[model samples]
Target: MSNLDSKLPELMRQATEDLEPESVDLVERSVAQGTRLRQRRSVLAGTAAGVAVLATLGVVVGAVQHFDRDGQAAPAGSLAVGPSATPKPSLPSKAPSGPVATSPSANLKDPTLTTLKSLLQGPSRTFSMPENWGGKDDGFFGASWVVDDGKGGSRVEVLLERFKGPARCAGEPGCRTRPDGSTIRSESLSPEYSDARQKEFGIVSSHVEITRKDGRRISVASYNGVSEKGTKHTRVAPILTVAQLTKLADSQAWQFPAKVSK
Candidate 1:
């Protein structure tokens, strides 16, 4: 009796082995689909968490700008985030302080240019000229004066030169040197620019030269005839004594030009 029962159960298992294959395959497919759905749900939850974090940061930045004095006082390290203002340039209210540039030729105006307009008035003084004589041209270095003889004769003149080189013509004819390094000279000549100058306007000149300790030399000359036939040609000889010429040369007036030139 027990053998038959056990044999009957074994026969039933053998009959279903081939027949259950389709049902077993359907169950396995359902289980794999459920597993794939769970994996997809997990990845979706991670992506959703990332997106929420980025949204929270954007909201925080907006709130900070709203409280930052209308964006005027932006937070530190925020230069790249705003339209910053550029500074305006300002002008100076006063002259800029600095060294002023100067040149070798800037000379002050000398008052002698006006004071010596009328050289001599009436009588001959130490060194004198006619009343009509005045300064024709003058400069920081020298001057020229002239007078008409009232006889169609050559006009006389006085000329000054400052800073002459090493006292040349020191002891020529009619020249003398003093113990104080001062020199005196007298010269007479005839201009043969044709016989008329030689006869009517022979030239006589008296000069005084003084050299200072600083290698500065001043020369003053008085001419008895128009020295500038080339320019201010007066065709008459000037009237003055050798003593007068020497006195004029020794006068300090010649230094005014040199003083202002510096």
Candidate 2:
């Protein structure tokens, strides 16, 4: 007979002999409980083994599926499956073409001259003219709107006037007399000056004489200093020859003072 069947009979005989009449019932119940416990333990062990095998198989299947999708060979203990793979396309190496121009004048309209005129009429906030409407004068043959730094901080000016012969030095105190005995003094001033001299005049000047290509000579001078509220103003002179000045006078870039009416 089978080993398990033989053991069960011997166990039952031992139980019957060892137990009293009342205790025999309790012993039988105990033996039945032990048999149930052994059966449950065997079922649990079998379930654990099945789970381990399934987990190993799942891993192998997944590895094979990945290899098939990538067009590679399936490794041992695995099966390949899925769609065929293709190499990805490369990108272009050069820049795309379109409009290539970038200079300021490329897309802009002409008559920047007229635009300059408007700017001069309503000079920027930074450029404040003298209270007496000093910008207009008969002495100035022509003028052009240069630029202002907008914070009342800096400015550039260009003016043209007819050569009224030569300038005399009588009005200015520091004017030097030339050896020619002519009252014509070089308008150039020394860079170094005493504190007393600077305090007397609210500005500094740099002067030079330039002869135009047409044989007309003119004096060019620059005046720079602080204005009201400590704003800096710079005035440049003799920007053009008398003939050139006349032409610029008609240009749109020139603006006469409002008070002057022309």
Candidate 3:
């Protein structure tokens, strides 16, 4: 045997020689201490891993909930993912009901209004006119037409009046100048202000009135009904545009004055 191996029991006896005999029995206690330390370390590691997993889960859940409440969408593993719903179509607005377009037509002329009885001359008759006139009426100094929109329901009347009054534009709307240097005002009549007599004619009406630099005024109204007492089915959309009404209202025939043939 090697020297150290053979002297191991003698060395143990020499090392324990200074200790009391009652205090030397520690082999079982050392093993128990080592086992307890290993168990405590293992439990601490397991607890830390569990806390980490819970923290990760909390972040994921919070992120998912935030995205859910927001306008944007979350990924597939998120809570209750679904496609966005489409919005429903809304209703159309209440528009001024009328024909899309008035069929092409020429100004209708009554024999009396077809000619302008000029003060300078006897009767000057050269003036542009739109055809398809339903009918015509001659007044003392004004003239009117049924604007002959064969459709009926709305009686689009075009009236040319020798504005007997001054060019008062203080309370008017849409006042502007035309290419011809005449001041014109396009006015819309409120349907709500319609009296019982006015309702007999139509729903709504508009007019174009113009005053020349010479203070001569001419008025034209494209109405829904045939006349102040015309029916609704007489015509629709007043059968004309602002330009057309202004042209008719400011016709040289009325500006020059005939003695507007009734």
Among these predictions, the greatest lDDT belongs to 3
Q: Candidate 3 lDDT, tens digit per residue, 203-247?
A: 565666667765565555555555433344355565556676665
Candidate scoring better on lDDT of 2 and 3 = 3
| Candidate 2 deviant stretches above 4 angstroms | 1-159, 163-202, 215-220, 226-262
Residue lDDT tens for model 2, 42-92 = 998999999989989888778777876686776655665554443222111
RMSD of 1: 27.0
lDDT of 3 at 170: 56
lDDT score, candidate 2, position 253 = 45
Clashes of each: 9, 1, 15
What C-alpha lDDT does candidate 2 achieve relative to the native structure?
A: 0.37
Greater lDDT among 1 and 3 belongs to 3
The prediction achieving the highest TM-score against the true structure is 3
Superposition error at 89 for model 1 (Å): 69
Task: Locate the minimum summed-lDDT window of 10 residues in model 2.
Answer: 89-98
**TM-score, prediction 2:** 0.22
Cα RMSD of all models vs. native, in order, equals 27.0, 28.4, 20.9
**In candidate 1, how many Å is residue 246 off?**
1.4
In terms of lDDT, the poorest run of 10 residues in model 3 is 88-97
After superposition, which runs of candidate 1 have C-alpha atoms over 4 Å from their true positions? 1-119, 124-140, 148-174, 188-197, 200-216, 221-227, 230-236, 256-262
